[model samples]
Target: MVQRRYSGRMDERFEIFLACAPGLETTLVGEAKAAGFGPLRPDAGGVAFDGGWPDVWRANLVLRGAARVLARIGGFPAVHLAQLDKRARKFPWGEVLRPDQGVRVEAISRKSRIYHGGAARERVERAISETLGAPVSDDGVRLLVRIEENLVSFSVDTSGEPLHRRGHKEEVGKAPMRETLAAMFLRECGYTGEEPVIDPMCGSGTFVLEAAEIAMGLLPGRTRRFDFERLASFDAAAWEAMKRGAARRETGLLFRGYDRDAGAVRMAGANAQRAGVDGTAVFACQPVSALERPEGEPGLVIVNPPWGARIGKPGPLHALHRSLGDVLKERFRGWRVGLVTPEAGLARATGLPFLPPGPPVAHGSLKIRLYRTNPL
Candidate 1:
């Protein structure tokens, strides 16, 4: 059975999936709730909510922890390739895709009768191409097909580029932390934008810049284009009005980032300027040993130091972590701390009074955990 609900306006209600790193689903759900998006349900890799196209647009524009937004168009049971072809051709592709535009089909199969992903993709591709008269290209809107228990569901990736791009920060350091992960980690540390943030190892200034933007109430996708704009249901005028209506807040607190490499310091500064947050984000070249507590109400210190796998041998990294622990204990009294690392041993090596570790989050190929400390 196909379920449908019309919103009685230009926008129709549909299911939206906000994709995130695996362990961050709960945090993303909190963000969604704070953004006034619900009723929400948490899933394995993302959060699911029911909304119209406008909700989809708002989610893509404002969600800081989501990697992408997927709109679930519709689905049906199809036990075989031929049935999938028939059902896919009958789908209302014209409702979302323009005839002149191109689309790419991707398929995943799990415990299904039609278990071949390639065959499933090919059939769906042919159906859409023949029925909708649209060209299939590699760089166009992506349509994802999932087959499980003989049921096929279709979703469109409405976010063209990953939300982490944020349409700024052209220059990045080696092994830089993603903006999405950085935002979630900040949230995990109980940061609410009222307090300042410091990143002693601020690689591309992701954490500092993200914290500054949060304080300013800036939309993450304010300057970026999304794949949803290419869909047939996109309303340019409404989107423009929505963008103009964003309420930006003003803040006086400063976020700080320091790196031992002068080049990294310069890069972070430049990236902050491009992000329109240089006023609130200060970058300097210094090692953790020289880290000084900024003058303010005590705030949070968040850092994503290099794991031994990326930067150096484990022995040196342990020494570095110990040194960092010493610096924070000695200087940053009453400040909270969040440290991200791939190894628990390295985290333990820090000797900071971290509360129990959080679940590991997948970043690239490594599983990293955030170890946090209360005010010290």
Candidate 2:
């Protein structure tokens, strides 16, 4: 069901959904509350709040855990395909959509008379193009419509692309962990961007760079364009002011990533430079056997090592985990560890004392879990 708010003006306010991976709703809510955004309501796949256009802009600018922001525009009852076309054509399209900007409608149907999803999409697309004069093109804005049990609801994706892109990090390893998931794992490990961070198996430096950005106070959407800018409610001056008001600070803390692959180390370094955190986020070509504690306060050691679901056979991966576990237990005295993988036996092979595993999180096709430990 589309969540609703009763107090605000019905015409001005709408339900805003911050979509994320299913199991990470709690972590996303944590980030939202820390960023001062909401009286959040966490559901299965995301968190929701009641807001208008400015709130949407702020969410797109500040949030790090959300994949995309969806604004619930409006809806009506459509028992059949022709009724969907009729109500969609009369849906006040001009109030939010412009005549020049192109739009492409996508829809899903479940337990409804309008069982054909493609046919439903065609009806909505024709309505927007014919009624509002917005051209229907593949490269245009995406308009999502959900029809269930004869009720139709519409939403538009405010973020043009997934938030994990972060407008940087051009190169990535084969089984790269997403930046959004990385942020959540960091938060779950009680990381507040205050201490040093080390990733012994950093692929393209996603974890280290995210920590650096959090510590430096850089906004996630600072360097990217959003689909909301093309909407009719966009206020250019207000958006620019919001961006200008955010300030980035210098951090004396060091975030390090050590990879055995020299090419991966070079790629991570280049990505850090592009992200403008090269001064604080440094990369070195090394292995877990050579891992050492940094010359400062103990921080979190988060890693996304090779596992059976994504790559590598279980036998060698188990040895790698054992080696990593041995190193952390010996050299690192006060640091906590967060390991991301799908194999439970592999996490146990680490031999470090990990708390009870959390619920499984969806990463591509594999269901991965985050295994953590107290300061060792």
Candidate 3:
């Protein structure tokens, strides 16, 4: 198959933001820098870097824990609705949206004259349809217009559904972590596919499966469609090439997950199979105490133990953390450990020396923090 080449040159980069879980911006930025995409600047919800459309697509395909990819199309001064309408009409809508396809407009206004978001959306929608011949839809082309002070900035949601919905997880547990967030947390935990990855209290195999996928070189978006596919300038041929050029293979990286519940083990296996990594993940119905060190050496051991908010009573959770800490300290040496917990006290229960915590990630309504110990 002929692979498609993105129109822009390799050096042509756009301002790309790596959206991460709250408090995870610096960590995600560090991951991007470690992966050599740097000169990263920390932003409100993510890290901002400059890259081309290819980088954008690659970020979508490879980034494990981003919420959404947004493109800063342009910004301008707009003190009134007329200026907003005229600017919206003149802005290159044709370059972003197809005339035949529909789009949905959403907006937020701060201390600006155009205070009505609905009015802004309607004006932008009208400009796209009347001036650019694009059809209008309710849910497509999520146009986010921000009016702060007298400046109006427009951004488009390049990632259609959040990257968390990798499209393979059909079944979700009561309090399932988003695949994107899980991946980011794993990265924050220092997972580099060079070490052993273990999710002891695997709820549904999210961490293990994501690790397997990364080790295998499978593009997370390989089986998924992006909103860019519906854009006017979307290059179907280039996308096909990128897709066909993807490398999928097995590796020696040992990924293991153990859940005390049998049903969770089954679900993890099923999710792995769905994600095309069933053969790679080692799933067990045993408890965390049974988790063994990878054959060769100690690497990165990461876990998302149960959070009390999702599982109800806190008694079992504390016991679970204590046991997990004991097991790690007793069995695994020379391995870096990472724990995700809703309560700092729960993490403290593990009796592990932890670094200062990062910002909390939104796991449902409860905020979860990632705690890491030194590289043992």
Report the number of the highest-lDDT candidate: 1
Mark the regions of model 2 whose C-alpha exceeds 4 Å error after superposition.
1-11
Instruction: Give the alpha carbon lDDT tens digit for every residue of 1-376 in model 3.
Output: 1111233344555567777767778667766776567687889888888776767777787667668888666667888899888887777676666777778888899888889988987888888889978777876778788888978777778898888899898876767878887888777776767777888878788888888888888878889888878876577787788788877876977688888889888888888889988878878899777877778877777887777776767998888889889988888878888888879989999988889987777666788888998865
TM-score each candidate. Answer: 0.97, 0.96, 0.91
Write the residue-wise lDDT of candidate 2 on 150-227 in tens digits: 999889988978888887899898699898999899999898889999999998999999999999998889989999
**Worst window of 10 by summed lDDT in candidate 2:** 1-10
Minimal lDDT window, size 10, model 1: 2-11
The Cα error of candidate 2 at residue 66, in Å, is 0.3
**Pairs of colliding residues, candidate 3:** 3-241, 4-238, 4-241, 13-51, 13-52, 14-51, 23-359, 65-180, 103-137
* lDDT, residue 296, candidate 3: 87
Q: What is the Å distance of residue 18 in model 2 from its true position?
A: 0.4
